[model samples]
Target: MADYEERVKLVKEQLRLAIYFAREFMDVLGKEKALEIIEKAWIKYGADNWKGRLQGVPPEDILKVMGEWFKAQEKVRSELKVVEATPERLSIEFTRCPQYDVCQEMGVPEICQKYCDSDYGAATLINPKLKMIRDKELAYGADLCNHCWVMEE
Candidate 1:
């Protein structure tokens, strides 16, 4: 298995390729159309990617599952700080994100928002009764990314 640094390098390379293709699509399809396509594609990808992984998770355990998921990611675990965890809610703060860092380095920081929106799709597929909230993001010039998952009443 690759170490965290190697994994981050691979992720950065993938983001670079994505940025390149996005630019090409924008040149041919126009910026607005390209962005629309990118956003929809990522949303579907996020939903499809997490649906099966979260299939059998009970609504009451959703927050725990999400926390575990983040902990499983080496890079995310390094930057993730769990602010609170309970049966009703889980709040986390991430001081850094490789995707946001790469996007900023590439001079297309706004592109990170399209990728960030994928979490909404993931949350919906995970469980309709669960709500995912993100009020701040490093990708959007915030000091940290604050994420909360709550079991809706």
Candidate 2:
């Protein structure tokens, strides 16, 4: 438990630095261009990582594997809550968010727009049929974040 907590803390700290970097880019390049750069980077990076992980897995098994992967990463488990998990979909509500927290701390919570939007690029790389819909986010001044990952037939 202690080790897991430590890992979570480490992950949170790294996320802080990542958002800080995004904020720096925002300062230099402006929001629009910085977001474009970040999104492109995430597309390649997310594709590489997901392709490697999902390799050899059948399309039918992709959602299961992806769900398990998401759960494992959410293991430190502070901000996100699983609302549902099925072969067709995985739904989650983010009640607390390290990214939002860090951005708030830095007084640039909107920086999260660049970071969160990358998820769409990464999800597409996972599977063309896999779609992610997010309705709200704390960074946008919402009460919480709602995310749904659905595997379309």
Candidate 3:
């Protein structure tokens, strides 16, 4: 298994490659079409990535489980803070995101939003009632990324 630094390097490399391919597609297919395809692909990627992980979790416990997952990742990949956590909602603030950093360094910060948008699909896949809301993002120049997960009424 790769160590933390190695894993981080790998993730950054993946982001760089994704940007490269996205730019290539933009050149060949046009910007709008390329972005549309990229968004759809990421949404499906998000859903498929979480396909079976949350299938067995009860609706009431979904937020709790998600909160724990975020907490566990606080120092591993990003600087995170659990702002609020309850049975119905989980809110977290990411002060640092490697994805955003890599994207910005590559001069294509907008790509980070594509990655961020994946959370919505991932949430819905995990549980139909789950919704992900993120108003602030580091990639868009916000100081932090705020992610809130809530159960639908």
Candidate 4:
């Protein structure tokens, strides 16, 4: 039989990999929607882990849940829709610090402890309302779905 310690170690490693995958995809996808997916994964992982700990579910069950999420992500990516982005024309918002968050917005904030302070540009199909831009090459796959962030993969 497999040692419990080794199994636990393996589970941690898998979770790390999943997180890495999520970050990579998020960078290319968008910050808003990507955050949502990551948060969902965490919630799912947490729930499954709890089940294993309290309900005697096997560790493999947790791994399986992670695997399913990854699979679904890949499946969706295979059919992603990339559309040509047109320059945004709406009133755009600018961030106080371009480097803190590193947004293209104008005026560099000294502290940059918060979000943008002004309107530099508007949300566009191309520009997107998302704060982060994933894969400059890929037209647009997913957008930030919450709190002015990313949402794909």
Query: What RMSD does model 1 have?
Result: 2.5
Error of 4 at 33 (Å): 0.9
**lDDT (10s digit) by residue, model 4, range 1-153:** 234445445544544455456557667887657655554544454444434543543432433343343444434343222222222211112211113322112122211211211111211221233233322211111131111223122
Q: Which stretches of candidate 3 lie over 4 Å from their true place?
A: 1-8, 75-78
Model 2 error, position 149 (Å): 1.2
Each candidate's TM vs. the true structure? 0.83, 0.77, 0.84, 0.28
In terms of TM-score, which candidate is strongest? Answer: 3
Q: Native-vs-model 2 lDDT? A: 0.76
For 57-123, candidate 1 gives per-residue lDDT tens digits of: 7777777876676656534356778887777887888888878878777877767778887677667
Best by lDDT: 3
Candidate 2 colliding pairs, count: 0
Candidate 3 minimal-lDDT segment of 10 residues: 1-10
Candidate 2 per-residue lDDT, tens place, 1-153, comes to 334446446646877776778878989999889878877875787678888988999988887887787787667666657777888898888776666666677676655665677778788878889888998977787899888889888
**Per-candidate total of colliding backbone pairs:** 0, 0, 0, 31
Q: Which residue pairs come into collision in candidate 2?
A: none
Evaluate residue 27 in candidate 3 and report its C-alpha lDDT on the 0 to 100 scale.
89
Q: After superposition, which runs of candidate 4 have C-alpha atoms over 4 Å from their true positions?
A: 1-12, 56-153
lDDT of 3 by residue, 43-113 (tens): 88887766555677777887887777777776565477888988888999977777777777787666777
Residue 69 C-alpha lDDT in model 4: 38
The candidates, ranked best first by lDDT, are 3, 1, 2, 4
